[model samples]
Target: MNILVSDFDGTLTEHDFFELVRRRWPLPPEQDPWNQYWAGEITHFEALARIFAGIRSRPGELEAMAEATGLDPNVGKAVQNLKDGGWEVVIASAGCGWYIERLLKNAGVAVKVHTNPGSIGSQGELLMTLPYKDKFFSDTTGVNKLAVVQDAMERAERVAFVGDGRPDLEPALLVPPQLRFAHGWLAQELEARGESFQPFQHWSEIAEILTRC
Candidate 1:
């Protein structure tokens, strides 16, 4: 079966989904740890965990923020079409799976999603449970984006990788020349090195290209 791998936050969604959370769900007065984490004082995992723990302290805020962000209208239809075409769609994102899963659930799009695990404390504080410096750089915010793609490629006959941010460049490069790369960034540094990359402003363009292929 054909396989389609995509990044979750910016690529599949309209914008950076987490930023919405940060904006809508500011930490309570006691939670200065999250602010320090964002300032680069602590590892991303630590910061993210603190953020989650802080948010969980509130009731129903996380779900509300998720509903506000919604999904990429264009990609939603495209993903459904891909599934109808017998393609196994998987999301390999650097962001936390906790939020992405809810977003996908809201979008009414069902697919295999691979991402870092997030936890909530007894007090409803959000914490990132994945340890950094492990096999996948557990402490990082954008963790192992490439490694997830490589794992997908290993299991599939042919794979198409799609992503938006600079973090995704590493994983997109791993696909064989024949595979497709649906990129959201207009110009990435990888172009200077003669890498095979394709720019896509919308998933509709990707749908067109995939249909031809």
Candidate 2:
């Protein structure tokens, strides 16, 4: 059996949701932890924890923000087609589970999703919970995407990964070149690293690739 692991955010949607949040809730340059993460001074999860600390809103507001983000129109159909073709589809994301689930549910796509758990705190701060805290790398993204992909690999005859960001890097690298699909920033990164991947811009492209395999 073939297992398809896909990233959310820019991979499934047209824009990066984490970036959208950062933009919508701009922090002062001196206070932006994301800058540290970008500069390799901190872990990804630490950056996220810091970023979420600045966000003060209700769950509904966050949901609205997720809903407003545009998704690939063909995603739902593509997922269904993959399922029909006997593939087990899973969304492996570094983004917040609440937001990812809301976005997919709103889009009418049902699939197993793994991501950092998030919630609106009593004071309205967006709080995120990391699952595998002990396994975090120095770049700690909180979400153990490599472990997720590795687990999938153990369960399937073959595993394919589709993604478009920094969080997708390690997991994508775990898969063979032919079984990895990357685009946008991820594509650029892979190219710069001289790694091979199937570059894509739409879900149809991914669906086509998985169908053939």
Candidate 3:
């Protein structure tokens, strides 16, 4: 069987959910952990932890806000189609598990999800945990997509990855050219690297491609 693993934030959804959270419940302007991560001064997990620490809202409120985020219109149907065709679909993301779950549930899509845990602590501080820390390769994003993809590769006859950002780059490289699907920024990265990949704008396109796999 073929396993299809995808990044949830920008690939499945119309917008980046993390960015949405930061925008809706922002930290102090002086605190710039994201820039630190971008500048290679901190790991992604450290950056996320710092950001979460600055959150004043409860988990439920954040989840509610996440539910308000939009997804690609065709994603739900495309996932169902892939499942109906006997392909296993999985969401491997660095985003919060609770947030990812809420968004998927709101969209009426059910699939296996692997992500970091996020919630509000008793002291009203934002709580986050890296469940897959032991499996981390290098960059500490908590949940490593490359590790997840590598494990999936061992079990499936074929493995395909769909993503749209920097986090997806290493995992995308692990998959063969035909099975790597890129969109948005990921496509640009692949083109710049001169790596082979299929470009897709919608999940329906991915579904169509997988049908013939």
When 1 and 2 are scored with lDDT, the better candidate is 2
Best by lDDT: 2
lDDT of 1 by residue, 1-213 (tens): 678777777676666656665665676645665567646687655665555655544676666665665466666687777766667787776667777887777677788776776655576555556635335453465467677677777777777878876567777777754454655562365466567766766655665566557
Please name the candidate that would achieve the greatest TM-score relative to the true structure. 2
- All models, RMSD in angstroms: 4.5, 2.6, 2.6
Q: Which stretches of candidate 2 lie over 4 Å from their true place?
A: 132-139
Q: Rate the local accuracy (lDDT) of all candidates.
A: 0.65, 0.81, 0.80
* Per-model TM-score versus the true fold: 0.72, 0.88, 0.87
Q: Please provide, for model 3 over 1-213, each residue's C-alpha lDDT reduced to its tens digit, 9 standing for 90 to 100.
A: 889999988788777766765886676645678877888888887887777776677547766666566677777788888988878998888777767887778778899888888877775556777774445434477678898899999999999999998889999999999999998889999999899999887766888789777
Q: After superposing candidate 1, which stretches have Cα over 4 Å from the reference?
A: 24-44, 54-58, 74-76, 119-125, 131-143, 176-187, 192-194
Show the colliding residue pairs in model 3.
none
Task: Give residue 116's lDDT in candidate 1 (0 to 100).
Answer: 72
- Model 2 residue 193 lDDT? 97
The count of residue-pair clashes in candidate 1 stands at 7
- Which window of ten consecutive residues has the lowest lDDT sum in model 2? 131-140
